[model samples]
Target: MVVLVLTACPAGLRGHLTRWLLEVSPGVFVGQISARVRDLMWARVLELSKDGRAIMVFHADTEQGLAFRVHRHDWQVVDVDGLSLMLRPHEVGGQSELRPGWSSVARARRARRRK
Candidate 1:
């Protein structure tokens, strides 16, 4: 199995980037993504550099798994394979530190809203 870390500048871009990644690679991918939709915007801004372009990063492999760093600016691909091992969630200590920033409070609020 392979693990990846996906991040976006703003919450809106995160969704688009996630969708793009899912559209590109279907079943081989699994992760969490969060973004806000205003019901008007449909695309994401993937800035590779300071030049303003969308960038996506992931890890891929056939037997040993591969790491990829993509620069959406000029469409550059850098492969870093056999560099490191993918860390499992359980191995990372526990769920105590899982909540970052305001996520925990936000989750509680969302739960209340749902109820």
Candidate 2:
């Protein structure tokens, strides 16, 4: 299974992706295709996503059941000890500066304690 999600992309790119995958939602596409085809589609997506964000997730043989990649996005999917996790982008100085929300600060504090 392969899934690709696009945000703030152009219409032409979205149409092109629709040809290869089903448009389950406005910008969400899902399909099962060969790796070669998927890679080809991703190439197009990268070329056309300008200023937009694209995320692709697929079934893989990795330690985690699924593998995911992001392009031009503020969030990222990371593989840690066979578990897929999401990490938000932070400022260069420190993450605390970017996460000003009380909940995020608390969560960060807890994460620090765990470390």
Candidate 3:
């Protein structure tokens, strides 16, 4: 088994890429999909890119089953034979700062430091 980490700068694109890969390869791959998907995911991502969307994909190899963590959330088990896992922003800790009032706390901390 292998672990792959995929990330997209923009949140919307991430979901779009993820869905596209799933549609193309089904359970064959897992983890976030982005503009890099084409080169990283190889032919499969290329087929999905025909629709035209910037995507990125990363591949990592693991000896055992792949586990995903995004935004502190554990992803649902996706049974695929290869060594890859797709992760959404929220699933991989990318959305950790998106919580309600997080910005306010950060601002307050910054203000305190400045003082």
The best candidate by lDDT is: 2
* Model 2 regions more than 4 Å off: 90-115
lDDT of residue 7 for candidate 2: 96
The residue-by-residue lDDT of candidate 1 on 45-68, one tens digit each, is 434223434333333443444444
Best by TM-score: 2
Ranking by TM-score: 2, 1, 3
lDDT of every predicted structure (CA atoms): 0.38, 0.88, 0.42
lDDT of 2: 0.88
Greater-lDDT candidate between 2 and 3: 2
Provide the lDDT at 8 for model 1. Answer: 33
List clash counts for every candidate, in order: 6, 0, 26
| Candidate 1 segments exceeding 4 Å error | 1-8, 20-63, 70-115
Off by over 4 Å in 3: 1-44, 51-61, 67-102
RMSD to native, candidate 1: 15.6
lDDT of 2 at 44: 94
Q: TM-score of every model?
A: 0.25, 0.76, 0.24
Cα lDDT, model 3, residue 68: 38
Q: Please, what are the lDDT tens digits per residue for candidate 3 over residues 1-115?
A: 2222333233443455455445334223344545354444444433443433332324334555233323222343344675445533463345563654468887787788889
